[model samples]
Structures are given as structure tokens and as C-alpha cells.
Target: MASFRKRGCTCEKKKCTCGAKWEYRIKYVDRQTGKTKEKSKGGFTSKKEAQLAAAEEELKINQFGFAENGNEVVLNYFSEWLEVFKKPNVKPITYSVQERNVRLNILPRWGKYRLKDITRTEYQKWINELRDHYSEGTVRRIHSIFSSAIHDAVHEFHIIRENPIQKIKIPKDVENTNRVQYFSKEQLEKFLNSLKTPQKNAKYKHSIQYYVLFSLMARTGIRIGEALALTWDDFNEKEKSISITKTLVYPLNSTPYISTPKSLKSVRIVKLDEQTVKLLKKHKINQNEVILRYKNYKASKDNVMFHQHDGRWLRTNVVREYFKEVCKRTDLPVLSPHALRHSHAVHLLEAGANIKYVSERLGHASTKVTADTYLHITEKIENEALELYSQYIKF
Candidate 1:
């Protein structure tokens, strides 16, 4: 319904109304493909401004033409397109992660370019450059963003004829660079003993709680975030089980947020051994004492199992720092909080726990992942089969 009409503009510098006038118009058209396109033209006081406005109008026309009627698309328009198209469809944690990757890695490189203009060769070159600078995992994640955005552009928006990154190959799986760590029984005892060292300083009396957190992680194999998201209600003293239904995640530049488990299987109930149950009972008593001592202050409803002395949820990074400190104090190898989960799995497998039980305990989607990840522990099973074969053979 846009009508094209020209309007005159007077210029003070020219001192002539007719000679210095500029024309402005708006036009709408239906393309042969049945797509509606709108174009606008505007005059400015200066010729430079007029040219800039004309170029802007031309870009708008191109953007409109790329999509069908009532459709709009702009690739790598990070703020606009991501908010309108991607954010609503994904979980908060996923949306936050995508936003971070787009802002930090993808957008800085590709934001200015249109989807149709980015060729596979150019994307390949960009990925190669990233490979030289970033880790393989980081490069792969960035490529995922590009692929997802371009795929949406092609299929949903009809903005591009094809996805240029459709055939681009990602690198083969690289061995995880992260060090594999498992606690020796002796080392774990030594670390726990170190945590029991009484703090002479009255300000830091919750050191034992730190030990409790470590022990829980080492015994339960729950993710640090999942542990942090636990509340009093999630635990069942009578049933002797802990329900893992939510996880706490902090994306870059975002506040800590609660998200559902990574998969349906991740929502699980893990039985607590008597020792772990006793530890939890003691932890509850300790938490109550701390709450009484700090009754003057308010606390959040989340009331995480572990908290700062001030009663705030313990930040994940802060926990990592404390872990490092504990290792240093105990003269142990540096280990991440997640290493405790791995240690738990390895120890359980070494104790002759079956693969199915291990998988269920770890809340894995299937037993295959548990078996694959812990293939080292299955060596005994293999040896048993070999021994059976040897018994049948008489040479």
C-alpha cells in the first residue's frame, strides 16, 4: 500500500529553492515470485546524507526481497534476529550460551555480512583462522552457530538459496586435553584430614562444610551445579534418596540460572548410602546452626546445601577456587570439582558395580555412554571371557 511520491527539499547553502531541491519517495511492489517488497527514498540537506539514505533504502529493499511476503530475515543481525527467532524456542541456558557465542565469537567475525553473500570457501577460511587461534572444541561450537543460523535462514526465512556451510567438515574428535584425575584412597583420606584442621580464625568456621561438599561430590557423582541447585525438599530422609531434577548454570555475562537437567534421564533419583545419609544429617544440623547464628540476615529461598558464610549460594567459580586451595593445602594434585564425579564413577566401577547400575546412578541416557567412557574398567570382564575360552581349550 505504499505510494511513491516525490517531495522537494530546500538547501540553505545553494540559496536557490528550485535548484537545490531533492526528491523523496516510497514505493511498494509485488515481485514475480509473489513477494511484496517496499522501498523508501529520502532527501537530505547535504548530498552526502542523501547518498547515505539512498544506500540504506537499497539495503532494506534487498533484505525485504530475500524473504517471501510477511516474512523477514537478517542473518547475523545478532540482537534483532536472535531475540525474535532463536531465544523463544530454546531453553534459557541454551539461549544464554548461544547469545554468548554469538557475541564473543561468531558475531564479531560475521555480523556485517548477509547470509547469501557468505560462501562456503569464506566460511572455511574463517574456520581455519579460528583453528589457529582457538581450541578444537571452541571452533566446533562456533561452527555450530554458523550452521544453525544459516540453516534457519534457508529453511525458515527463505532468505538464502542454500546453506553454504552444509558440507563443511568439522574436525575429528580430539582426545580431551583436560587431565583425568582419580583420587587414591590414601590421598582422599589425606585431603579429608586436611579439611578437618580446625580454623583458629573465628571468621572462617565453616571449613568443615567445605569438606562435606567435597565428600558429597566424590561419593554421589552429581554435577557441581546439580548439587548447588539442591534444596531441603529434594532430599528424602525417610526414603534415603536424593532427587536430581534441576541444575544451576551460569553462562558468560549472565546471572546464575536454574535449568532442567540436560536430558530426561538426567532427572533421576539416586539412593544415598548410610554413610552419605549420616553426612547429610550432620550437614543439615550444621546448616541450621549457621542459620541461627546469622538469623539477623535474610537468605534466598533456594537455600543451597552449600553457601557462603553470608548465606548466598556458593558460586561455581568460587568452589573451584576453594578446591584449588584445598589441593594446595593438602599437597595434592590440582583437580576440578568435576574430577570428583569422575573419581566416583571410577571407584564404583572398580568396586564391581555393573555397567547398568553405573549408568543409572550417573543418570546417563543409556548404558552405552557409561561403558564407552569407562572402558578401562571393563578389562576384568574381558579377562574373564578370555579365561573361559582358555578353560575350553586343551592344547
Candidate 2:
């Protein structure tokens, strides 16, 4: 309900000659916070005008749950939206990624600005600024998170009329495209061999588990997280396959936990080669001997295939550091553990495997995604296909 009053007049005592404008104040309970808030406008010429304006205000409140008043800060609204919508819907790791980017990128710049005041020109400028400091991929993700929140504000909350960040183009990355993200077959073989062959006078010895882990990743192209989440039950010896149902979500700053795979397709089964199966079988026997050697040692209750000596999920950071060291020792290009996945994809394509088969084997969402990611990496395969096409054509 709204109350109308005359302002700039001494009407409480008696009617005066001074002119005053009519005002109407509507009080509404905010559904998001469960608190009453007031919306008022003054300077109307008459009480009838005030009442008509108040009706519009009341309609917006009733329809949209609250009237924005165009003064709400972006940071406050985004925080509320993140909690109410995104937190429950996304995975913990995904939520953390969104929250971290919002804190580090979005809030630092536009948090103080009112949602109604942010124009498209300003948003595009901010996106360009972000592109200057971060990789195109990183900026794209940050932009996506921010734009998604804005979209929900317009469509779901009616806080804004439209999203200003729509149709914004992400700037190209400045980083070198030629920087190696994966390895050739020979380099992959060398890296794996370094893991298996014992190093003399080494500060720390490489274990058989590390060898099997890399071997599995190279052979099957499973994610590092999926490989870490593997347990004895996930493997089938007779079938020569591994079920990729879950993945490890190990944040660098927090304790590790098991989560579902990256997507629905990521939960599919991955067939293993004979050599990888033999490596895993050998690793299991070695793990059993190690367990017997230490009576007080506590093995991970889940029986994870690759774990710390005390039987805990291995940290990806630690694995990555060791992987880099192995690369340095063997004179190979140091790349992240994910490179094994890329190498596996490239190897399959080079061996004349069907694109659809490789896509399914790698658990990609589609063959297009597979081709887009690995097509550039398979230059040799492309040349060979071109050669074959030229030979067959006669015109």
C-alpha cells in the first residue's frame, strides 16, 4: 500500500499559502531478503498523479517481487545471484571457479557501479581491459560468468531491462600459438620410459604407480582427475577397460573430494591397450608388496589406483611438478599432465582412426569438438589425406 502526502508545506499545523508537491510512498516486502523496503517519488503536481504513479510502482513490486529503483550495486546483486542460483546448480569445483573469477576480476572493477548505469560501451571496454591482462580463454570464461549473471538478472529477476554484455567479442590471446601443448609420439614414449627406468643418485625415486598413471593417461586419454579417482573396482581385467564414472576435485588450497565426471559423456567406458593393462597388473602387485612392507600404513579405503605412499589421493600439483622434472631430466618439452590426453588423441588420428571413434574413445561431447581441438595438431595426417585425395581425383 502507498501513502500520499504533500511535501514542502506546513500542513500539519494549518493550510499555508506555500505551494507543495504531492508524494506517494509504497512499502513492499523484498522476497529475496524477506524485509520491507520503501519506494517513493515526489514532485507530482497533484494527489491523483501521485496515486497513479504509486500504482505502477506497486505493480512492479508485485510482479517482479521487488522494484530495483536502479540503485542496487552490481556486487551486491551478483553475490545474491551466485548464492541463490549458481551455488546449488553447479558443482563445487565449478562454483569455486566462478566465485574466484568474480572476486578477482569482476568485483574489483564494476562492483561499485549500479546495474542500470552500466552501458554496453563501458562493458566492452572492461572486457578489452581484461583481455589485455589475461589469456583470451580466461577472459572469455570470466566474461561468460558475468554475462550469465546479468542475463539472469534481466530474465529471472527483472532487475534490469536487458543485458549490456551481449554480443561482446573476446579479444585474441597474445600468447604464442606455437607454444607446445602436447608431445609427439617419440617424446611421449621417452617421457613414459623415464618414469619407468630408475634414475641413479636421484634425490627421490620414481615409483611404479607414477609410471602406470602416465601410461594409463597416454593410452586412454582420460583426464588427470579421472585417473586419480580410479579404484580397483573401476578396472576390468578380462574386458581390458576402465569405467570413468567419477573424477577427483582437488583444489590446490583445499582437501580433495570425489565428484561426477566433467560431463555426461565423460562417464563413458575407455578401452585400454594390452601394454597398459599389463602395466596396471604389475602396479597392483607392486602396491600389494609395498602394503605388506609397512604394517602400520593406511591404504585409501577406496583403493585408488594411484595414491600417496600413505594411501591418500595424490595432489595434481605435486604430480605436475614431478612430471616437469622428469621432462627436464629426459630433455623433453615440459607440459602439464593434460598433454598426455592431447598426445593420445593426436596419435589415434595419425594412425587413421575414424574421427567419431576417437571422439567417443576420448569421451568428447561431439566429433566436432574433437576435430576442432586436434585438427591443427594433426598436420601430418592432414597432408596424408590431401595426398590421397589428389591421387584419386582426375579432372
Per-model TM-score, in order, reads 0.74, 0.82
What tens digits encode model 2's per-residue C-alpha lDDT throughout 260-314? 9987888898888898889889988888876766665557777889888778998
Summarize candidate 1's per-residue lDDT along 1-395 as a digit string, tens digits.
32332355355563556644344443545333354445445555555566566666555544533433323323324465578777889898778778888888887777666555678898888888887778777888888876887676677555566777877865543665433466776777787678777556635574357878888888889989888888878889999989999988866566777889878999999898999889888988877776666654334466677776666677888889888888887899888888788788888887878889989988889999887776765766678768989999968
CA shift of 56, model 2, Å:
15
- The TM-score between candidate 1 and the true structure equals 0.74
- Cα-lDDT of candidate 1: 0.72
Query: In order, what lDDT does every prediction score?
Result: 0.72, 0.84
The TM-score leader among the candidates is 2
Q: Name the regions of candidate 1 deviating beyond 4 angstroms.
A: 1-78, 172-187, 198-202, 292-303, 379-395
